[model samples]
Target: MRRSSVATSFLLVSALGLTACSGGGSDGDDGARKAAEGLATALAAAAAPADGASTPSDPLAAVTWTGTDPATVAKEYAAVIDGMDGIAPSVEVAEVDGEADKPTATLTWTWPVVAGGDPWTYDTTVALADGDGWAVAWAPSIVEPSLADGETLDATTLLAERGEITGAGGEKLVTERPVVRIGIDRTKVTAAAAPASARALAELVDIEGAPFVKAVKAAGDKAFVEAITYRANDVPAAVRTGIDGIAGARQVTGEQALAPTRDFAAPILGRVGPVTAEMVEKDPDAYRPGDVAGVSGLQARYDEQLRGTTGRSVHAVPADGGEERELFLAEPAAGKPLALTLDRRLQTLAERVLGGVTPASALVAIRPSDGSILAAANGSGTGGQNYATFGQFAPGSTFKSVTSLALLRAGLTPQTQVQCTPTVTVNGKRFKNYSDYPSSAIGTIPLEEAIAQSCNTALIGARAKVKDGDLADAAASLGLGIDHDLGFPAYFGEVPPPASETEGAADLIGQGKVLASPMAMATVIASVQAGTTVVPHLVDGVDVSVPSEAEPLSAAEARQLKAMLRRVVTNGSGRGLADLPGGPVIAKTGTAEYADGGTIRTHAWMIAAQGDLAVAVFVQTGESGSRTAGPLLEEFLRAAR
Candidate 1:
């Protein structure tokens, strides 16, 4: 039986004086054995820490140990509790060998030299003698075999340096940035003044006032109630001086381990925040309550890779006072960088193009050759949402490129004569072209001219030449709606089959159930520009490699579409790009209409190709696709070149 049972039985025998319970021996020895066994069990539990807390497993708490020194035992127990807060040890005591008056037994225990490492086991002896009843003889040596005069347990942490997040060209996008936590030092200010100080800081920093006041007021005296964290370079000198004038207001600067720009590719790169209780509970081995880790985005997606192993060390110090001796330990390792495909220059350019636009816009650029994403930028209007790669919006006329592919598959060449009507009704649903539809090219125009003009009714009229699945399949052929791992979250645009003729007509024009992200549409333009469906990627050095299901556009289809798109830039609505310094720019312009709050709003979209880059840019509400988004597109391509 386990030693604890023997000690437990000892308590019962001594308490009941069960002389008749034993066959040949007196219950005295049995009681002594049980006491020793119980002591060993309790010691083991106390030594092995669980989730950062100490628990005593010895069965000796119930019975009073008669000969035990209460004060000595209490101090000794307290020392053991403090020392064993973070270790796992096993202890076992053999049955008593001495007589009842001065019973003694051998005890053995094994302690791990380091958590999850080799162990150190040793044997010692303890005594159980008569008192008010049988009880343990407590001593420091009972706790550990190496115990001498006086020693206590001690621990110290060894932190490992975190890794860096690198961008394309291997520049550090996120490194060890200097930061400051500004808040009220409650102790320096009166309770009545804390609220005013907190409110002043909140307004200066533009954070909510009530929460700041509540947090400051609730904090104990001498507590530093942090209101906000900011990078040292970004905080204004004027604001710092203003806070200095307020008593108890202060800024504590330190090295914050995270990215530099708060909004720079946040949705893709991710953010770092305080380690939550859930994080500590879920990963006790990796995270602690006060640690900072990736809370969301790519940081959260690849947290472990970025947060390397941690090291620890435990020591034995003299309880009376002396230098600590190393007992157990491990070394921490620094994390490695996560390579990316984003070009810092192009990403900065994309952001600059959408800088002043207030209506949730995005600009995405991808390489046609390998589908490597060059830039994914979201405007301030998005309020931190990753609209570049996940925003679901109709491509408007931008999707006509997909419809064009479907048409070309049906033996309809760019020169195939198709009517560019003012309005075309399908199954009682009416679709109209833009109000400025050129009159001379209205009736019986070649498909090439129709596409160049972004003639909605032209494509709606030609919708009869294809089935609903053709539009979806064509989009899929260009990498839309196809599922593959990118090691992060994304929506590759969805072009589901139309349920009715009205839906089909709308689908033909890149509207009516046709949903896509800016990144998604960029891929569509890229496929045509590159001749094969392009799979966009972000994380470099990841296993996102997948086989392509899309066949490159046939030579005839490629030749014809290229000519048609080029005409759109030269002779059609996209004539805005005629002066682009990048010279020959091929493109398509789209103005998709949607109902918001019962009012019609249009998304001006422009997808284009200049040399090796395929780009997609959008504006939530605009006058026209070419006129509204065209200037931005031209600026980007010219600057890119």
Candidate 2:
């Protein structure tokens, strides 16, 4: 058993009066043992000084000092171990043994140095004598065997190298990159000049100056208040010259984890900087003030794996200019790399294609061959949200694919004729085709032609053939409406059973309570291209389990769905993709109307599968899918090819 159990049993025996000097020692020996145990308890409670809190005046108060003043000894002991992070150690009396005239006690001290690390354990002996009373003989070596009277322990931290985040083919995505920290160094200027200098620096950096001035005023006398950090190449020469002219302006070079460009997958990869107070409070042993840690996104999700162990070295420095000896050392460990399934080139191209789109747009690409997510790009208008995998909106006519599947399972083939009209009504609610529905394809036509032209009334007219849960079941087969943990932030969308007749009619056109994300729409195309259900994933080595209750998509059904979708590109709203260079492109186009603050808006959506690539493009506010989102999708597919 450990020393704590032994100490507890000893105290229990004494409390129960079960033992009386079993070795036949004198009363003085018992008194010495009791005094040593009391000293151990105080030592265990003596924490190191933190946040300017004063050290305990006497941790050995229970044991009277015979050879030295107790207060002076206590003060010296606190000074020597001041650098050990003020962690209270577990101290216990290991044993008490000696001649009757002079007794000695061995104390076990265990210091918890790091999280999940081996503790520093040691044993030291303190002698007891009868000078004025049963007291302990004080010496500097009682705390630590190697300590001298005037030596102090100095702790030095060794920083660990943060790991890189790698993409497909082992390409480094997030890695250490050079940067310049521009700030106001208060040590170089008077207190009155610091705020002015901060304002000037902020102006030169093109940042707001008032907040910088306020922060500089609140900082310490010699603190360096950082205003901004810029990539080494991004800093302008004019800014550098202006900084040199300022009295307190300074620029410090450093390295930080960064992507290829400023907005390249920023919302997903996250960033790292100084550790916050909340992080320290959450895990005091793992974090401290001034430490750099991950703050958001995947960087925060796998922080421990990315931020390796920090090494430490404790040295005994002599006060009389003697040689210092190392008491302990722990070597720093480098963090492991986080692997992802994204293709860097494809992701860059996707972001570039969506660069001009406004109002929360997203483009997601998945490889149907293996279900690997190749790209998930958010447009500049997203306001820092990861809209590619999380944006929820009506999918519009793109959801007709699910309706087609439900009808196919209802014994309707691709060539089966369905009535195509200008408008259809359900329960006094009128549903009609898009504004520019071609007059050539409007009468009675095959199911494939109705899908190609995106006939809303045609699908709503046939909704009576399928039952209540048919849409949800068909959506599950196409990889929608089922949630899976893909080891990252994602929204798989919702497809519920229709609650009323109007809602059921609206379901046929992908509106009225139907919601889907760009990633979810991309997965639907990937599933059709794969001839089976496909689950998209980004992080490598993460297991994903698809729901077992949903009916699996058969190869025959996928083939029939692909045939109808191909006709969509050949003659329907998806005609924009007809001239692409890639081998056959199967696609669907959607334009769903929504009310935003009493003003009507439409969500433009386009999804297509070309060769092994499945892509989905969505524009929150657009006129039509073929006109707004179709061009961007074509550009990305052309570049990717």
Candidate 3:
């Protein structure tokens, strides 16, 4: 019984295992058949047209469409297949209703034409596909290829905040714009007989008769042109009537007009002109025609700061046969005003002081503490001729100050004994003093007395004791033989360093080869008065500033120099200045002989401090310093104070 039971259990287990395996196989077959049927149905549906039509009117009825050229589409498809190397599944076209006329029937996409924050409208044409979406048809226009690299369109007019040019006490010296100008449009008087038009324009505008007729004829060729000349200060009341008389004439404000001052400081202030081609070629971005620029003095120096940046705009115009449009526009820029360090009172004083003297005389005054050029006035020569900085003459006895300083630095004192002989011989040359007086009458004199007396012999005798290089170095330290770098052109006054020992001896007496400008001589006296070496400045503080590192002289030396200079006014050559009412004056005088062998014609000079101001005057082809230049300095000093 146990064996029979074991046999039945084994048969039952085998039967159950076989039955389970067969059932598993049948379920796998069913699932495979269902999946195959679903795929076949999808393929058939994709290939067939809508509504069960046998064939469609369009060749691309069963496939999604895009606007791209057929060649590009083919290339993209080939590229995708090559990229995948046949490992990816193949793509099939899908069909939809009205696919023939619709390029992207099943696809939808959002295309952005104009970029963000753009105010103008843009035209964008996009292509669509079945499921891939859309792309831009063309790229943004790169229209500036013909222009030079980095070049762009810029506005012609510029607007800027002007600075004020004021006097020393902060009073306004330069005024701002206060009026507007109205111009007539001369081009539109197109009547067959324009006599009435011209007469009407003359009535309304400032121009008249022949000029008005000429302007109208010239402007007729231009579309919109301004009259050659317009009314300044105010618009004429008749302009409205004149414009009404003409068919299409108009009255408007012109962009260019005169500033209100009417050339108050004309030559000094300079004028503006159109930019030239040479300037543009040198710097492509620097300037354009019809732009105003500084032509002289302070104007030229501070042009960059005075002139400012320009602005821009747009005016739209309709494009031909299209929805797109064109734009045309511009914005103007204004200029900045300049503030000067000039004292108007002092300038007027200088002009008056220079008037009585011949046109050859020149004068310059400056403040010592800061090297601020207070006044500069020049007598006439020619156009743009300013002798104050440009004239070169023998400095004469004024150079004695430099010679004395050299002697002092070389261990000589005011009491140093120096014989004042009529003539002294050095290196085979005989150099005579200014006068032919005997040495007995002017024996050994004190250095201070020699300077006060304007004794040429004493100065040359004293200079003999010092080396040539020392005198040159001393004179240079006092601002000789070097350009002061003032805004305008200045001659450094030729004091060629002595080439030989013989030339050196001649230089000592203010003879042979010593030259200086009136401006430079004034600077020397100012240095002595201020007790420090200073460069004379012009154009206010724009050209130069006081050197932060300059060291001043000792108080004792300053006091001694001041005392010696004072004696020159009270008891010596400059006694003409002694009678002035205000206060004590200190001065020096010079009468330099010309190289042309005439009588002492050009008087070179120095007028030291009178109260707070110092003045130096030079008169070419004039009398002695005392007679010719001293009186002018005295007159100026009294007026200046």
Using lDDT as the measure, which candidate wins? 2
Off by over 4 Å in 2: 1-28, 48-63, 66-75, 95-106, 124-129, 135-140, 180-230, 234-254, 284-286, 318-324
TM-scores for candidates 1 onward, in order: 0.81, 0.85, 0.60
Across residues 49-78, which tens digit of lDDT does each residue of candidate 3 receive?
243433223312222223444244333333
Q: Which ten residues in a row have the lowest lDDT in candidate 1?
A: 16-25
Residue 534 displacement (Å), model 1: 0.7
Query: Who wins the TM-score comparison?
Result: 2
For model 3, state the Cα shift of residue 543 in Å.
8.5
Instruction: Assess each prediction's global lDDT (C-alpha) against the native.
Output: 0.75, 0.82, 0.53
Which stretch of 10 consecutive residues in model 3 shows the poorest summed lDDT? 107-116
Q: What tens-digit string does per-residue lDDT give for candidate 1 at 1-641? A: 01122433343334322211221234566666665665665555444434233333332353245456445565675575364435445666655664644567788766543333354556777866565455666776776655655676555446556678887789888788898878899878999999999998888888899977987887667578877778887787767888988878898997766664677787788887666668878876566543567888888778888866656576777867677777667676777778778888899889988998988888999988887888999999988889888889988998888888899988799889998888888888888988787888889999999999889888888777897477777787777877667876778888887788898889889898999988988988887787776788888865644336555567777777778888998889889887877557789999899889999989999999978899999888887788888888888998998
By the TM-score metric, which is better: model 2 or model 3? Answer: 2
Clash tally, candidates in order:
7, 1, 13
Q: Can you list the residue pairs that collide in candidate 2?
A: 48-86
- The list of candidate 3 runs beyond 4 A from truth reads 1-164, 176-269, 311-337, 425-430, 433-441, 481-494, 537-552, 595-600
Error in Å for residue 507 of model 1: 0.4
